[model samples]
Target: MGKSQKQRAIRRHNPMRVPDTHLPKGLASASSSSSKNEAVLPIIQKMESPEVGERKWACVAVSNIIQNDPSTRRLLQGKNVVGALIARLTDSEEEVVVEAMGSLRNLCIDGGYDICAEMYNKNILTPLKAFVPKISTTLEQYLANPKAAPENAAKLVYEFADNVITTLWCLSETSNKALNAINALQLVPFLMSFLACRDRLPLAPVTAAAQCLYVLSDDNEPAIDEVRSNGEFITSLLAIARTVSDARTSHGKVDIRRLQLGVLASGVLKNISPLPLAVASDIDIDKELVTMLLPVLQNTSLRDATARVPVLLSEQANEVAVDKPSLKNTPKSDHRSPVEIELESIENQLRTTQLALEILTAACATLPDPDVSKHDEEADEQEDEGMEEEEIDEGVNDEMSVEGVPSKDEVKSSVDLLPSLVPVLIQLAEPTALSFPPLANPSIHPPTTSALGAVHIAALECLNNIFLSLARNPSSTVQADTVAAKGIWDGLWKSLGLVGTEFGLGQERRKQFWELAIGVLWGVSMVWKGFLAPDAQEVELLKLFCNSSEDERVRVKCIGTLECLAQCPTAVDGNKIIAEYLFTLLPTDTTPPAGVEPAIQAGSALIDIYSDETFPYDVNFRANGYLERLVAHVDAMKKLVKGIDRRKPGGRELRLRGEEVRDNLVAFLKYRKALKL
Candidate 1:
């Protein structure tokens, strides 16, 4: 036969293509193609056919349809495509199982929670869990004699394992049931084994395994505890994060793979509980993680977001009228160009920053609380030694015995990242500008609110941790130069002022902000004596917020800050401000039930100030009418307590608080009289 004749014969007998001539009349009509669901039903029915080839083709077809058109996913789900595919997971044909798993993964990709919940209800996890032991046994056999194992067989093992982990990861994204079920099956150790696999596995499987672990750990305390207990696993994750971060830094470009690895590792680290005391030395792991995360926190995109004006304003550079109506008439522009928008949307960096902060918070939580009794004993021991070594340099003696600070190594490790973290935190806390020329007409662009409130909260919490670590470790010193260079204290004070003035903030938000600011202040004061005292503006801001803010929570936080400031002898103005506020609250007719807390706080603060022998007794108290107010407050409290019913709900508590204030005032009065002031 001629060559063309032979080709024609081959085409006529092709087994791959089914002749349309065999289709039912309904399916043969073009009208049947209008609805994807109706058109795909025949192929889906083939998925359960007895013929292996038919089933494989059906799986491939369904995967392609779901991949090409997402809308068909819901239709496929309704048609029980998941049940058919999940059944094929145990199919003898490798290609059939691969296609089935692949199709299910695609369905779950953009499938909302309902799809996942549906899949979970269909016993998809039962097969997935069953597949793990097979893969493990295969991987073990391959590892036993890698050279004897066919390369293709090894590759197939990894491929199946990757698909399984990926599908599980998708389900985990929306279903805690899947997460807990997988975790309960001891999959964490299996996945961690993959991470620590000696053979150089492809990034796909490793990344999938890490991500699965991350999702599993979320809100699952048992999973978290499991991961934490596995020190090797934690170490492997940190190593991966460091390697990826360093590689990205060296390349000076963002690799999505590296970003994904770093984010997943940090996320897992964030979920794990703090390291145990026996493994306290592992804090270096945390330090390394922090080092890896610093670059991400300082991502250039966030910096650009902070520094740039709104895109609309930047595009309208030549326009002068800043009114909203005028700006609306201006031609529309995509202020953030596509590339900038993509950069902004790359949320891995932000997620990394948040995760880093959480890890640091956990690390700080593990530190031993400061020992007040130990501090006193240490002070007494230091005084005895000081007298014995009278000729010893006083400065040297003071440095050696600074009470409340942690050991030098502990302190150093904790604050190692503070210098890098503090500045980025300050930037995140501040609101971005809306216009380049400062918005001459306010209506065009009112003040833009920062969307990074969570980041700010995390940063503040981390800063509080750093401060506490430093304060408790009196032997550890925060260099004045370091604080000034980073503008750490300055930024904190500015944040306090900004939050205090922000009237648009929700009551709860403002209260939280104030509480964090005050806590940070207290932490700083404990470490750096007179740090709060010398900042008159900060002290005044606290006072202003206390007196003017209608939110009782804000007022309470401000009063707490005032109490902290009053403890510093150098803060004479702070003491006076606190005393005056207390005196005002002391008047029985003016004091509300809510007022008692702050008033009592103020009285305790005054007692602290008076008890300090170094306090300027005559100048701050006697001359400032503080003493006279104390006497009148004591008298007023005594009168007020007489009218309260002891059995009433809050009356006894109020009376008790009032008496405590009077007792504090009476003690202060005695101290002042003994001084002959």
Candidate 2:
């Protein structure tokens, strides 16, 4: 990990990704060009109708039209559709109010952040306030006699309850001001009640309640306090997420819905991890959650790893989604069509796997307090100085903890789980096994066997953080570095375990681990032959990864690893294979996008490769097209550097690095000319 990527805010499955399974769909989705026709205007006008039926129909129509259509959502918002929907929320008919709440929830989902703020500005929460208490009453009555509440409400009470709760959850997530209003609902205990009734109630309503809790407890002080207060709620949610069911359907298939419910339940725990949710005063939530999640990662059936000839090189290779789950390709079926079921099941499996990795990632993410006084710089430096002195004076090392607490780099529970985590992360981090005869073209995304490339990417990210956390702690037994020269002389990477040790690598893992191990070698000051002469396996791994057409973003990670290797003088080597692969990533036919970060990474590496005294392919500089490529890459870097906006944050540093790289390349060229070799 570079300085830029050392710390990251834990990721959440975007709350706005509304699974509107019961929402209106299959109606003609209004197109973007319909904006000019004022198509939603008529619907908005009808939404204000005096007749309840007309208003109800219009609300459902709006929901149907805008569920997956951002263009129509914008068009609706422009026509004051939010205000009209808010009007429907207070309709005399409860049915109309429920449908309207559903529409507004879809708007919040489809319209993105702006529409959410607009709904808040319209005071949607004022009506939303009454539904919580009402649902609490309905839930109790319905649980007592499952059919009784629906008969009384005239519509299924659970659906009515779900819409209201989910709608409030969506709105609260998007707008900060909406939190206070939602917190006042005193909704934690009520939502927990719904979660407790999951076995009896429909999954949608149960999921809605869990989702409501997730949004509430995520970084919100008042809401987190509410969750900590309702101890059993958190306990039950984690238990559902943790339990892997063997319940078979009548068709003898796995009960996937129950499993997906686990995904939702786990997602709630993931969203608010590191916040203790244990009911028992003695139990530790972090350790308990880790124990529960380890088995989820251990299920080897989930990983359907694929091997293929590089897609750019093969005739049989089809284009896989670079980012799967694009909105445009989402199944259009309002009902559970075969296509929809297949896609949903695939996505659900991917989500389940990802949620497991993310929860582990988040649990391990012991990031420094973001708001904890940046102005105390002198204090931080003094502390660092003290930590170093303490390590040195003692000769051995300080315990990785202080007062039984882990450092900023690791979560206590995560450190305990690393022995298990390392093996799982390394295995999952492997890309679609690309059979590469190094293509000259820039890396293209290939057909990953079981899609969800995000799962692989997430695994890598979580692994990177773990590597950092373990390496930085002196007391950590996880080997992250070799000594400067003797460590290299004795056996290269032996200390770091990339070559040999507890976390030993196989043919595939060696490469994936090689890319990650760059951060481990970052500060080691060694000018040794081992750095220059990588073993055949290590070089082959680099060659495959740099040219691997798995995912472009994953390829960028390799480029970044290369860039880090190039930046350090001790780490840089005269490996011809590494240079050839680096050049293959840069474009020759086109001037690359000036603002693209990947282009910067490749260019920066190129400059470093040629700038130093040792050149990867110095003998074939002119014959092998290295000279021509160098000049072209330099020109491209110059253009990008000049075009960069130096006024922005890190902009000046980026531009300066580009200039330095270019200057060093020029000096190297001059030295080559003077030597006449």
Candidate 3:
């Protein structure tokens, strides 16, 4: 084949789609021409050409068009186009494979089970098998430098995994590819397991992990069975955990050993008995791995690691296995850790333990209440009456309700047998220490460093999640019930007031830590809403939160929190300064940040708050023309919604939230004749 013809074949066979919003023509043409459509037409012509480069361009054009009009997606599934794309996967050209992945992603976006099954049957996944290893290697390199390409690569892999997950599991005839898919499952698992274990990892990984896990962990019996049947693969995971103790004894850094033990714990937790037994034989329930792992927590370095490990492990172990090893069993020379310990010590040694204690408490609290009211043999007459109307379909709640959580006796016995870390959490969130953020210019307070600032923020987040857990289900123990709420509310108030601070002595670190603190507080208010009362104390807290002097990120979260609280029946004022504050963040008659998706999303979510008809507000009250100000921001919202859809095409659209804003705005406008203009 001639060079031109090979290029043509490559383009024709590649399955990737082009994004639709690119101005059709190159910038030079766009600038010269009066009409954007005229400029775009030439680009379309080039894309549709059978020439090699032309076809590659055409694929991009097609993808772009697909974003605007959903109807053309069926064409990609046609034999003429799809067969061409599949052939390009093996074209020995990197760009061709990239384009092929893109095309396949577009076709598979939001496809039904039949569509996914058909795509799988057509051997579309074969290309992905060859493609992902290359992409993963490429992304691993690019992530080091931080570029657009590697992120795009990550997105493509995420889309493919999502499609396979949604469809019913079928082992592809291509054995090598099926194995590769199984191996690929490890990446998603690692990512999800990381997020599940700790929330401190950066946002990119968390977002990517959630999407990937959602796809891979969908309940498909066939996939579950197939993964489990690969003999001893599951057992080997448990057996490998024993190496952690070996590593620790060999004088390895306990942190690394604890992390490995943590991962192993999570792996077992995710795959329970039926799944494990299907893979491994002669597994002793009594000699389960938790006992071996529990000793690792003795080293104070392993506290946080230990905490997360058990949430996953507690789920794996039966009643006997979990209680056999105790925190008391740790060497007596190791003193009992107390809440009065210094804030820095808690940050370094015991924070993870605090989190683990919260998890254990939650697991204990969520367990089914033991069957207390038993059937009586003496109720012979009632038994006959019951037999007369027996309805066979008794379904149980999947989630344990607060009312049905294990009794005080059950929790006390289970937790008492293990290590005691509840005091560590209390110490971290206690009012006596007052771990506040450093001033805006830390040089002004030379004694405190940025590391201190970061530690302060992390402690706040830990306090928040702990508070959320407590509020979700208050401990029945009288002592616990008395102090948990007070300690949490006090810390929350202090953190809110310490809003303007710099962390790590640099602008980026300062901003990052600030954003984190805000997220932590927002998490507290929103996550614990179900268990907490919206009393006067809470209203005052909300007022302090929204009264921001600096840190726009802090203000943004405050807005979200207040929005949530406003919908609460006991909120003090429904239409308070929320609308005005939201309008300030939005782009005015002025242009907004050129292409910052995060900023746009923030604006959209805020707008949605004012517009939601479901939002609890008096019909008579109105923020100074909130709809009119919001209408001026419509262009910004539309741009953001489009950007999100474009960026995460096969992924969740931002419009799910944006649409709510638009609808509410329309409804509010219709009701208030004066505001319509």
Model 2 C-alpha lDDT per residue in residues 228-280, reported as the tens digit of each score: 65667677886787655543477965555675567556656655545462455
Off by over 4 Å in 3: 1-489, 493-500, 504-511, 528-558, 565-575, 593-620, 631-652, 671-677
Kindly indicate the candidate among 2 and 3 with the higher lDDT: 2
How high is each candidate's TM-score?
0.56, 0.59, 0.36
lDDT tens string, model 1, 414-484?
66656677677666654333211111222232122212334455667766777667666653446464454
Span of 10 residues, lowest total lDDT, candidate 3: 1-10
Question: lDDT (0-100) at residue 479 of candidate 1?
Answer: 41
lDDT (Cα, tens digit) per residue for candidate 3, span 93-145: 55545565555555544222323446555676555555435545543554555
Order by lDDT, highest first: 1, 2, 3
After best superposition, candidate 2 residue 21: deviation in angstroms? 23
The candidate scoring highest on lDDT is 1
Preferred candidate (TM-score higher): 1 or 3: 1
Best by TM-score, which number? 2
